[model samples]
Target chain A: MTRPVTSTDVARRAGVSQSAVSRAFSQGASIAPETRRKVLEAAAELNYRPNRIPAIMLSGRSRMVGVVVGGLSNPFYASTLECLATSLRAAGLQILLVHVDDALTLDSALDQLLSYRVDAVVTALAIGSQRAARMLSDLAIPVICFNSRLTGPWISTVVSNNHAAGLTAAQVFESCGVTRPAWLAGPVRNAASRARGHGFIAGVRANSARWPDGVLEMRGDDSYESGYDAIRRLLARGERPDGLFSSNDLMACGAMDALRQHGSLNCPDNVVMMGYDNIPQAGWHAYGLTSFDQQVDCLVDAATQLLDAALGPDGGPVSRTRVVDARLVTRRSTARLI
Target chain B: MTRPVTSTDVARRAGVSQSAVSRAFSQGASIAPETRRKVLEAAAELNYRPNRIPAIMLSGRSRMVGVVVGGLSNPFYASTLECLATSLRAAGLQILLVHVDDALTLDSALDQLLSYRVDAVVTALAIGSQRAARMLSDLAIPVICFNSRLTGPWISTVVSNNHAAGLTAAQVFESCGVTRPAWLAGPVRNAASRARGHGFIAGVRANSARWPDGVLEMRGDDSYESGYDAIRRLLARGERPDGLFSSNDLMACGAMDALRQHGSLNCPDNVVMMGYDNIPQAGWHAYGLTSFDQQVDCLVDAATQLLDAALGPDGGPVSRTRVVDARLVTRRSTARLI
Candidate 1:
């Protein structure tokens, strides 16, 4: 049998450099149309299908973005991941997904992604330690944290303006004549949750003179069960807040259920509820929850724009943060009671 | 500046072949521990870090699996992807995720995955056409359809026993002393939905002799709004289903909300509801929906098993289907009234 054709043979046949042949097959590679056409013609004639792995090795660009994700059960993260995948694919990149159970396994997840030599990484989970961030910077790998906060050289963050969202929630509650308010915060270590909580307290303090202290805060692990139990336990103690804001929609839904089941309270009539992340379930007829729309498409657009800049010809990995405004979607859950 | 050390340099220093050095760095490669240790020591002394892309080029194994996903807004699909990612990662395989907007974009998604030369593919969407299946077969790629049914050469499918779940739903409804039963089917092209509908109809006919005709059927595109509207439209026509089974849990929750909000009917009181894919939302206090658990972990285990066989020694591309049994989880939605 005759030897199989190679990129070298194609280059000789097409009267172009072997690198030109490789570029002709690589997506998003810079090659003149005429040269690409000639190279393709030669490849077709010679029945040579260039393998991508070898081309990636030659160019040092795998054209793949590592995406590390956790907590997909949360609709917010799931939807964010879905949008990110679509946006990245449109940019001529594929997602190398690494799913971690929690923050504990994140280091290993990063190690695995690094082993694959992905062009860059976009994660929905926080890059936990300074050591991991330094390692990524050392490798000159650009990372974009989607909806998560991370600060370091060569790192970019695209997130919803959580602080603004919290301020808006507080203003809405005050406008509804809510004297007593409560805040259901997410996990303690979550930076976004902390920012939102701070903003909410600041807004409450700025608006009210009677409240020297901040709103009642309940901590949850960002699960539906946690949200339900938090409210249930608070209500059991005979302390009821007329207005409540949850850091996440899933928790807000759980809180609503708890109020109705345990406290015999109905939303809008009894307790006005506001939540972050306007997931699809927030609009269901059962729970018309008023939520902050993170504008997932806009977040994705900003992320891709940052990625493009970082991977561009004059691209030097730089630290940047793009904060998209969160808009409020009004529904029955937060209707003005007063 | 010092020249970068290569695998060849490591091989020379370790007194081993270059291929052995490559294998030593490659995850899950066949290399003796002693040889790997020697290679690692030599590489460390030389400050050599093996780039995975070049190793993949030499080994022809990218150690990556392509996962095509769609409709992540649906909780079931989102959770399924999470499980698949975790399982694949545990097996020392990375996931290359391709997100498609719908069936129309599936072809392009597959093309992108093919360019990456993924070791295998696991899709949540159907492999729509025979041409696409043929293309994958020609490439000698092993594809496992997770919770999807596709029959072709070199294809493996791991799906829940939909028909059995349907039959069980029918029996549950019958035992609840329901005279009027209704089946809400998912999209028309969905094989799992069709099988479940068939089995439900068969069960209805087998159990009830009085009814010559099968139960009433409603079609939905497997969206929450679609389920709500289908039930609302039927209710407008004064057709009330005492017993209802939705092909998916999201739609069931929608149907339940419709029954309560529009028809002023309560589940297990005015109507009993059953759903498939025991999503986390099903157990929410608001719904408490009885559903068939597809056993996501088992399905993932089976898919990975099939993948191992296809990629193992003496492994050849073959067509195989593994149907995991779907178990019914009882809740208030289907609680017996009699």
Candidate 2:
């Protein structure tokens, strides 16, 4: 019924320049507190709210970020997403979420995200292609790769020390005096998965009696069924792995089931299971799965803060990698030692 | 270095109206296939991309939907979100996701979403206030409520037959011929949870000689620990429940663990467990939880399609509800029969 009031109207009423009015509404903008108060008072009286688009347009920024996440089936990712989404929203940025159901669909999701002039791109999926990183970097888009190894200087990354986690799994199993050991890995080329598996092998070589020959390697599709099947196949052999290390909590859950139904073996009595990513279920009285905690919330928060800096004080984009420590949570399922 | 080509430029080259070009790129838009093919060829030859915002502005629509979801802590929500997001995208729309952590913060999230004039609002959270629904409807905003009852004629809803799911749980337990049966319910006021509990009670009253008192009732925080503690409390009583029905899979898993460690009771032999919402974990060998399947993908597809029709030729917003059937998934944990 009436013309909508603008920053100009507020500026005139407050006896301040339009730029001052803009500064008053913009967070971290430079303006005198008294002038800001005056502008806000006038704007409120006139029932005027600043349009969100103009400020972003003036700054040549979208104030939006694209987040590509996969593995929603995993509780760890699902939990981490809550924190990540909240942290970004708190920073005054909106998240355009893209879900990648599978590896092939992941690239397409990334491409769809790239079509937008997003301030930054974050991915829970691993980035294996150096070319992809370079292309995003060329577009002046800051890319944050989560739970993946940094391959080149073009992309930034944050990950738990999967390599060390692997070693911990192996040592925990060895301390339990397991005669046979196996490591179940997800997807052959995932940097994080590979790191965890290699770390376990390295640890086994350092402490176990059977260096290379005794260590068994199992590949999984990162599903509970994969862990279930891997164990079923492992038992078909003359010797069964007394200790098994699963790359993630989901697979570890499967391995635990396999021990119960297939082998009719009891956990921590005849066998022990260790998993990475101490998801909420790890503490559930049902499983009490001993696993490594990735400190996902902390990592995601740090990544969000870094993206903020990259957009502002840090200048365009800088490539760096940060690895956080993974803590071992000792629970009943992995409580056995000798 | 050159200015980005616009839809207008492509429109001119293709000898078509700009509106036609816009509709050609828009999915589900009424445009000729021949015109769409010509537009694509012209756009490709000129290396043009329609600016993401201009078309939306021209149509006076954001082509974006605001999704309000709570209980991301539940695997069911995360699993459903992927399908919902994809379905929306395929229909030429974008999603703005808001996570409702608590009721107090829900209003603020809604306020922010409303500021954008989103084409519609879809929520998985319960809308308790009639005034809130009326306000949105007055603004010509179509509200799609998931897993909630239709409170008013202004709101549309999609939900599983929670009542049927409850009855299924009770029948399965009765067939197992348990001396004592118990039902675990979520928040006392949640309509879906209440529907499930009442249905279970009704079924027990019909089938079992125990009638009302013998069918024990338990309430939980809908967490694994809550289920764990619920079972512990039930066992502390002189007569432990021989059959347990958890409102959700998470709590059931906890109940199962409590049976093994806390009571030294065996599954399917000493006690039988049935859960609702057969999440991915229910099928895992460790739990083998017999649960009700909500058919999330089908439900999500139906919701998306409803939103489409509401926005298109379907005319004015209609307050209606659709209920999808919940099928019983039989598993090892609930295999024992009388």
Candidate 3:
């Protein structure tokens, strides 16, 4: 293997000091124009690119944010990552991405992020364990949980107003005269699903006296297959839901398909469907799914703002929660029956 | 802000030398068990973390692979990223992700990756310009174009045999006895889409004299809306195609919705549709679209194997291309009619 050209080699070739070679590559660093030209010429000839690792060590800043994400199959998460990446990049920061598959991997992913000494962390996954949370807090690294919340001195949260969105779904159901409404919840451990479900059930109980029976709740893994199977099992039991609220758009699409395949049921005619996270597929002519737009751009903006504040010169260990409002986008799936 | 604890602080607290503190933190470093235990205790007390930046500089290996991706709205790309991340993580490597939105941003993203001194780069986007290709080659960085191909001395490619997949689509159309067929291609610069379109056109010309009328061609941005608009325009021109081959499954779904919404045509019965990248949604009961499975796992395996070989000892600037076979997953969308 050939040895990589270093700044020292460029210094020798340019007839300048090593510091001069470094200054030529360092942005905003002072260097004479003639010396800078000489250094660049030598660098181009030797193919010597200035390395950032040692500079990062010296400055105590990597200018890299650790972004931990998973569930790419869920378009919502994928979209969230895209927004976060763009927002971070615009701020002149790079993303050191850690893709965690599950809870077990989340711990190790956090460890890897810590080893890299990321300036900050923005995670789509929830930091579930207190041990992990405490570890991050001890290091004084600012963490901003995107679309998820955790309580810690060093952790901040930016999430959608999921509870209010659920209430909006219930209001839509009531206005449509939908009785026996069902709530399709994500995993039992998912906090966002739980909050949405709680608000929906509460609204259902408070609104209609015709609703003596509580809403039917089915748990899914926030996957299309899970949603499809959940509805299939419900139908097999001869139970029909007049209205359905899903935790995400993907699951709602699956439920809609399952209902259509049942042959007797039709959307917005026999049943109304509402979903969270207004993903792109929801707008397809085939689905026209009514969903809550989590306003990913707003969420990303809030997260980045928090990141900036925490990473700024006056940055300190502070914890705060920012909730962005989610608006409901009505489509054919949730059209009024009356 | 409080100053971060350094190795000197830990060494002082542990009654050991600073080098001993580093050795204790380093894996496989020669250190006494008692000394290591003392260093750990002091480190815990001081909330100190051994920074990896300096170690990376000393070893000249970042253990990070730069992964450039875009089009997360497409499930195919999302799935590909998940597979790559999982495979790379298993090999104990981290990913420095660069999310490029377009060609202009792609150059800057590569520069960022270069400044990080990434060990290898795997890009989903085509490295189009000769200058960019030459830059990577000059740096002796092993560049692997995932699901894309580029010709350079240092560039390796791991992609599905898209042309063969196109031929398979043509065969399906022929067997279905389709008289009029159309090819929906992606962006003009996309090589994969061009290859598929070429193979499909070639196969159509070679196989059936009944196809002398030739296949209609439409261009899209590999988006759902693009496919929908392309079909709408074709229909507006009073051009009716009995068969359709889409560059991606998302566009296929869009085209399917458009046909159904037109109120005159349907899938398989009216128009047998074929798509590439059998994403999760392809199996949904709603679409049940027939598409080619790129076998993401196989592609990821090949890419990682090439990466391993390139980053291994005795590694050279070798160029090669490994093509994974893509198989057709038949569904109701392309069912044969007697």
Candidate 4:
């Protein structure tokens, strides 16, 4: 059998230096047309493809964008990927989706992205890991965080305002004449969760005197099952509040199920409820949920903007932060409350 | 603004040749430890990043897999992506997700994937165009079709037995004493839809005089609205079938809604209905849809196997087609019929 052809063989056949052969395959190279033709002919004959893994040695545009998200199962992240891909096509770029479930070890994933030499990196559902932030800063590549809590004067972030959105949910419940309210909080330690929880509590405190000292801060798991299980546990205690606020729509949907099953926990009639991240299911008549719209368009636009900045002409002194606003969409679930 | 530091500048600062600087950073290259140290230190001081994009010209392992799919609004593809990611992770690969809607040309998408030199292309919901198949064939990079049809043995494919699964549904209906059946199919000219339709008709005709002309084929979009509309249109004709088989669960759910509203379609009593793609919602009591499982593990395994062949040591001449088996999932939708 003939041995596999190598770049050296193509170089010899084309009568060009090894470096010239490499440059010929690299995008945006200034190789002469005749020389390029000769190199191409030789490569075709030998079945020699310029390997992309060693792209560090060449200079050209990869036309690949590295998209980093925290979760694939989360409907928010899933929908974000859908929108990002659409926007990317409009911009004539392709998305390389990377899921970093464990936020702390983003370095390895980043390294893989770097190896591919993608034009930029966009993160959705990023939980402000210091190591990840530092690595991204050091990489000096364009990085955009969608719905992440890395907002500052320097880093670019495209996320709905969790703080304000949470506040709006609380005000909606209060406006419905609810004297006593309970909170179904997300992970207590998560930055976005903390901000949202604080905002809601602040709103309820400002309007109502029946707010409990220890807001039923059941730590959320950001899943439908977790929401259902948590709410069931809370309802089992026999002290149900007049209103409830869930940090995410999944949990709220789960809470809806739990409320329906527990005869004592009536909703719309007795206890009004609201949630965040108005996912697709929120509009379903069965759920008829009221939640915060993370502004898919604004979020996607902000993410693309960060990517643009990351790949800007200068690629220097990147934007510190960008915050997109979230809006409250009241459906039947919260219609009575608002 | 000051000029951005280049690799040439790093070389000058490190007192080394440009090639030596390159060698120092190149993985697995024979470079002295001290030399590599000097190059790194100089690069940091000058804020220089080696032209990473050039690696696209270097080696075949871009470590990037292109995953093309359509209809993110559908939950099945969304869930498939989740599993595909895990499978790719185990192989130490990352995914580049490309979402193409109906209006766009898949060939254009393939062109984009080609330009990025993606290691392999895996399409979840679309088929590779003849032109793309030829292009990839000439390029020697495999284009693995996941849950699609393959006309020739040259291309690698991982797909479920839609035809057999359809037959399974018919058999269930027959055992349940159904004499007449109507089909709710996907869009016209879809290969998967056609296969299922043909198989269901064949199964119904076997061992029975029922359905002399086979089940009535009604075309609809693979969505809830289409399903609802198709069933409504069928019912308005003043003729009804004893059994219903929707090509997918979304449409089946919609059909159930229409039946409920019209007061003519009740599962196990008025008519027995079934769907395919066993989506999560099929289990809901509101819509207890019996369906067929696509066997996600087998589908993923087949794709992985094809990729292995394409990138294997033998350079791939033996493996091409793999068909995963589908199973009939008995649920309340068909329980009374059975």
**What TM-score, computed on C-alpha atoms, does each candidate reach?**
0.90, 0.87, 0.91, 0.78
Which has the greatest lDDT?
3
Instruction: Point out where model 2 deviates above 4 Å.
Output: A1-51, A103-105, A150-154, A208-214, B1-50, B103-108, B150-154, B207-214, B313-317
Per-residue lDDT tens digits for candidate 1, residues A1-338, read 24547889999999999999989887789999999999988876775656776556667788888888888888888888888988898788878888888732255575565456778888767666677776666556678885555567888888789998888988898788887899999987787888889889889988767555669989988888999999999999998888999988889999999998974777989889998889988999888999999898898899899889889875666888898999899999988677
lDDT of 2 by residue, B1-338 (tens): 24657788989999999999888866578988899988888876775655566445456567778777656768888788777877887876777767667521133455556445467777666665565565555545566777765345446788889998888887788778876888888876567788888888888888645545657888887888898888888788855778888888888988888788865688888889999889887887668899998898878877876787778766365777788998899999888746
Predicted candidate 3 versus true structure: per-residue lDDT over B1-338, tens digit per residue: 57878899999999999999999876668999999999989988988888777678778888888888888888888888898998998887888999987621145465666666788887666776677777778768788876555557668888789898888888889889899989999987788888899989988988758798888999998888989999999999999999999998989999999998998988878899989999988898989999999898998899898889888885678988999999889999988554
Model 3 misplacement above 4 A: A1-46, A103-105, B1-48, B103-108
What are the per-residue Cα lDDT tens digits for candidate 1 across B9-42? Answer: 9999999999999898766799999999999889
Question: Worst ten-residue run, lDDT, model 2 chain A?
Answer: A103-112
Q: Which residue pairs clash within candidate 2? A: none
Cα lDDT, model 3, residue A329: 94
Please give, for every candidate in the order listed, the TM-score of chain B alone compared with the true chain B. 0.87, 0.87, 0.87, 0.80
Q: Quality of candidate 3's docking, in CAPRI categories?
A: medium
Q: Write the per-residue lDDT of candidate 4 for residues A193-214, one digit (tens) a residue.
A: 6778988888877764555553
Clashing pairs in 3: none
TM-score of 2: 0.87
Of 2 and 4, the candidate ahead on lDDT is: 2
Q: What is the lDDT of residue B190 in candidate 2?
A: 66
